[model samples]
Target: MYLFTACCVLCGEKVKANISLCEPCLQDLPRISCCCYRCGLPLKNQLNDTLCGQCQQSLPPIDYLISSLHYAYPVGHLVSQLKFQHHLVHAKIFAQLLLTTLQTHSLYHSIPLPDIIIPVPLHKKRLRQRGFNQALEIARPISETLDIPISTGLIRRAKYTQAQSLLNAVERRKNLRHSFALIKPISAGHIVLIDDVVTTGTTVYELANLLKKQGVKTVGVWAVARATHHYK
Candidate 1:
């Protein structure tokens, strides 16, 4: 059990303990009602949890992906508040939203849950500057709720690559090359990668490829939001 401040982080309206944001404020955020289960990108005129045209032709390395919200306006601002301003309580809200999406998508039948949750690692240098890894914080509550252990110290940043936000998709891919290394064997066959946002899909793709090469059976990405509805 955790305690949250009575006021919402965005509008300062009083909120319940179950959620940090007020209902009206929560409704204002852009949501991905129907997203491609494989890429986690919004799908137009399609049912929820269905594959998009791109994934239909060629499957991606990620076996499953889900992002509850679109990274627009207040959602992006809220992410910034947590990432930069150290508003940690927002992680719980993110976890709730993601859990809702996951369960909603799996309403008809059981969707196999990942064996472990691995929040994206931050290089020691970046970790020092940020004071915390937002991804890990968000993953913590989800792990607690689902009873899935959060794995750490397995995959680490091998090099402090340039920040992804400043780079284009090509540059982002290049920047992340050889950036992550597995320090030990991942015992879990199915794993979930947690991140604050999915922008170009470069970083997760790189890490997923690394895991696949090492004989991991499945990889799923559960992000708080997707920067764009489509892959860049």
Candidate 2:
């Protein structure tokens, strides 16, 4: 039998079977350790609380947030390549990273495995322009690996809003107002929302609100990366 070697998607360094990043690159990755359990934002002093000050004051619509990496450096670059440059390999790499994170979290935390995965939808116009939904692309491999089905038609982006990254928190919220609509009734008790990166989180908040309105009991977010305060 012949053997095969894999190369790191980011550094192009040869890696062992079923992995992407080299040891140095993997060590350099900005994995989130101490973070708010609700929003997954990195915390300065974790202390006794799993939530940050903002979350303690007011909880987000989401029940839990699971993010693998911080939206910085190489992670950001990889997301950009998948989102803008149409490099599908990056999406596969991201899905693999997310799978690893979920497996690790399941060891210690009682993270509920979702009944179904719903990738944040894109507007039809945007989908036509881009030729692919990055969220769905990122979710495909994850769904396959985790044995969770993905539903692309459960939620629809009704409004063609401006990019969330270009707007402030208030503007982002306003932009997404009435932007998403549930396409059908959801029977799943637990649902996982998949996204490439979560910034101010206004987008997911809006989506979560809609899902809850439709009687989705639990809404969890699974993102490849989470934005830091500096980026937000």
Best by TM-score: 1
Error (Å) of candidate 2 at residue 226 is: 0.4
Candidate 2 Cα lDDT to native: 0.83
Q: What is the RMSD of candidate 1? A: 1.8
Model 1, residue pairs in steric clash: none
Instruction: For model 1, state the Cα shift of residue 77 in Å.
Output: 0.1
lDDT of 1 by residue, 84-174 (tens): 8888888888988888777766621356778889999999999999998889988988899888999888899989988898888788988
Report lDDT per candidate. 0.84, 0.83
lDDT of 2 by residue, 142-167 (tens): 88877899998798999999988889
TM-score for each candidate, following the candidate numbering? 0.93, 0.91
